[model samples]
Target chain A: MPPSPVAVSAALNVVEVAAVLAFAISGLLVAADKKLDAVGVCIVAGLTAFGGGTVRDVLLDRRPFFWVERPQWLWGVLLLCVAAMLVLRARHFAVTRKAILWPDALGLGLFTANGTQAAIDLNLPAVVCVLMGVITSVFGGVLRDVVCNDVPEAFSDHRPYAICSFVGAWALIAAEAAGWSLWASLLVATALTASLRLAAVHMNISIPPWDAGGGGK
Target chain B: MPPSPVAVSAALNVVEVAAVLAFAISGLLVAADKKLDAVGVCIVAGLTAFGGGTVRDVLLDRRPFFWVERPQWLWGVLLLCVAAMLVLRARHFAVTRKAILWPDALGLGLFTANGTQAAIDLNLPAVVCVLMGVITSVFGGVLRDVVCNDVPEAFSDHRPYAICSFVGAWALIAAEAAGWSLWASLLVATALTASLRLAAVHMNISIPPWDAGGGGK
Candidate 1:
């Protein structure tokens, strides 16, 4: 039998928390690379961790925001920010270009699945659900890059970021259609998304930049 | 006696539509300045026209979005964008730096008052209501500049943008406290915001940037 709704919700919360941690770490690394102060780091980290889900909730008209409803998640992100900042400072670690990839991949996969699930629960159109999943996975990083005055990697880098989320979201939908259990669907989708992102990064794979002759300018 | 709630709401809608038009124009100018193609222009214009109110609605838990509920607003912005694009193309008009200021100021005033009134109708705390007002006024332009890969003038320029909205929001709140009619409050507040913004621009008034040693890093 499928798991109880309550069981599924609790499991989803755990996954969300992990994703938040991963996103927070990526935010901190980006802030450090930008040479931001402590407050800037905190702001970037908070925005990166909460931005995507906040946007999704707003789009779905969910009241009280996710972090507002569960203050613990906000607190968890704050705690992680402090810990990560301290560790980086103590070790005098220089942030490398690849530093954000692993955690960002984890966050991308988890958030994509969770966002898709929430839209499914709301009975939105399938296309919208998949789009929401991609938005939830990528918008935080987009916001972070924008705030830091860099071109949003999502729009400019020509990377496979949102594409990975898109495919993974469909995978989850397909799994459910194929009569897979909720847990099985979530696990498989998340794994596929993370693996795709990691592979893209490791292999330096990217979509081609829009050509000047393509009417982009 | 104060204006009837229905009368006030109708007036507010008129003001909001005007603001949306102004904001859309500014977005188009910015996108054109950046030499974005037609699709990019449409995206930026739509974002600037809708982004702030959408953010406010999300934060306030208002459903369906303002444009989503009244798709006429969406249509209106699109029409304005197309019209402006054609005019600019036919004339080969260069987008001047000064072109965005007037419409942007008008939008700041109108959106600030409308957002504040919406929060008051919800009976939120006064400070939060004022904050919602400022946010609704400024966030769209911020999003536009960021997407265009410019430093958000709201954060970096210190040219009395958000500060004007802040003061005007409080003016509306204070007028209400003193038993003014809703129309009176909105008019005075909008006038105050627009005048302040215009004066700041004409006078070249700006707050000094934070000192390099102030630790913003």
Candidate 2:
């Protein structure tokens, strides 16, 4: 027999809360690692937590943004930031937006896999699904850096940020095409993205900026 | 007599093209005024044309973002950029992000009115309506500045950009409440917001940044 609708909803709610917390912690970790001001920290935390999912929901035409539907959870995000700050400070984590490279890479992998999986579930077009995955994983950190007044590290750091997520999204598609189990596909994609990001960072991989033009304007 | 569905659709497509052109021209005006790089100019133009509506669509769960639905318009945006660039080049307008303040003010009002009207049509909550208005008017510039690697002048320029739009959104609500016609309400809101923005810019009105805290981090 199938689970009751209420039971499924309850389980989904638990998963969502856990996902939000995880995403928030990644932001908090980045904030802790960076030298962002208190306001910057809060903005990064909030954007990191909600930005990607919000974009996905909007693209999919899902109503009542998760954050909007449960505004109380926002307070939870704030408190989590406070708690993360206290703990990270106690542990003497380096704090600066630059530290974003670490946790952001992990987030890139997780969100890329999750977003791609979501679009796949919806049976969206292949290109659209891949784009959604990329948007979900990359947009949050982009917002984080934008608000913090930096060229988004995802775009400009001479790094392979979006590329890693892009590849990871494709990996999910490949995995499913190969008849992999859903859980296995998700894990493989996430791990592949995260590990690739880590490898890129550790190896100091680079991508050049675009060429300048007439009047360079 | 009621128009045929095809007739109405054709008319809407025409209106959409006109609106897109107007929005694109506003961005071109800003790019023409500012001393931005070529890439910056293109980014600004594209964002100005599509940013707000894309955001609003996402929030309202409207599907196939206008640009997405009709990818051809994207090429039009690119061509528009090219044409605007040449015309502005021969005419010799100031070129710098600073030029953003002018056309941006006009966009603020127009998008604010349009966004608010869209939300009002949906019968969303009042606060949500106001926010949608603000997002539609302000988000494009935010994206433009972010991509240009400048702190969004909308937030950091010590200006009343968002606030002006905010008030304009409310004005639309009030106009509707007072039984104004839709066109009248839209015009009133747009004119009010744009003029307010102009006033703020002309006066160099400012808002202070948040106070720094422990570690100033």
Candidate 3:
């Protein structure tokens, strides 16, 4: 039987809210690092928090995005952003440029997992689900970079394991398709991606396409 | 009866492609004015062209957005951007800042109409459609401003009639819902919006409160 409307809505709400918080924190940290004023920080936070979900919905042919449907999601993000700014202010702290990777990776992992789950719930094809997961995980960062007047960091050569999202998302999709429990798939995907990214960051691991002479047979 | 999927897709493809080119050209003009190098110009052009639709899709809860669905669209945009750069190079042309408004207004009108039509097709409420239309038309410019490291000119006092989008989109939605022909409604809306914007530019008229506040409002 089809899921009841209320159940469906509840599930969507839970996932969306969780994902929004994850992304918002990521944006907040980035804004802090950039030393943006409160309004600028809030704008970045809002964009990062909603950017991925909005992309996911538009691609899935969904309408009146979650934020628009329940505007409370936006309000929640706004409040969290304000709270974050206050906390920073109270501590008399400033975020240096060096202080922003962990939260971003964590946010990426959570968003990817949530997007994959949303796709699976919608009964999308496996490839599409994986794509959605990756898009959801990355588009917000892309938007953030553009706003910051930088090339999308994901596409830059210095980025490490940025593609981890696609790898782990595909793995999660496979696991779920193979009958793994939802939470199990989510945990595995999130852990796999985050760990890979952290390790890559620490080890200075890099992808191999730079050597022009190596490609020829 | 449901519309034939093939026909719908075909029409969507044509209109969307046209819209993308129009906006890309507008972006190219802006970048040319700034004397950005090729990479910068391409980035700006692509951002300007796809930015609005990307916003629209996300807001509407769509997934695997049009660009993602067809990676070829990215290639097309890239090629056009390259061509634009070559043309500018060959002619040693300078894009005067003053030359941008007409094409920009045209792009805004087309995008607004297309966005509203998409929302209406999705059966969204009229209010939502008007909002979507405005978002689709203005978001690219907003992103452009952000990338250029400036406040979106629209948000600043110098620009007025940006809200013409909100007004015209609503007018179009009302007309269409009242059983006006699609072409007639679209043309009327676009003409009205473009005229109002051009007049605002010529007359140096501005949005009332925003224009008068002079910042820090």
Give the per-residue lDDT digits (tens) of candidate 3, residues B1-217: 3346665566556657777877887788777777788899899999999998887876666777888988898898899888766655534444434566777777777777777777877877666687678778878977877877765555444445447777789878878768876667777777777777788789887543311112211
Give the worst 10-residue stretch by lDDT in candidate 1 chain B: B88-97
Arranged by lDDT with the best first, the candidates are 1, 3, 2
**Residue-by-residue lDDT tens digits, candidate 3, A1-217:** 4456676566556756776777787776665555445545666777788888777877787766777777666668878877766555412333422344676667677778877777878888888888888888888877766665667778885656458888888888878768876667787888788777877887888777657756866
Residue A138, candidate 1: how far off, in angstroms? 2.2
Model 1: lDDT to the true structure: 0.82
At residue B201, what lDDT does model 1 achieve?
91
Clashes of 1: 0
Lowest lDDT sum, 10 consecutive residues, model 3 chain A, at A90-99
Among these predicted structures, which one has the highest DockQ? Answer: 1
Query: Could you give the TM-score of chain B for each candidate, in order?
Result: 0.92, 0.76, 0.83
- Please list the residue runs of candidate 2 whose C-alpha ends up more than 4 Å from where it truly belongs after superposition: A14-46, A58-64, A68-139, A146-217, B1-26, B29-44, B58-102, B174-180, B213-217
lDDT of 1 by residue, B51-131 (tens): 898889878988666665576666677678666665555233333346668888999999999999989989999999999
For residues A1-217, could you state the per-residue lDDT of candidate 1 as single tens digits? 7678897787678777888888888888888889999889999999999898888877987678778878988888888778877666624554434566788999999999988887877776666677678778888988898889876666545567877898999999999889998888889889999999999888998754323313323
Q: Is candidate 2 or candidate 3 better by TM-score?
A: 2
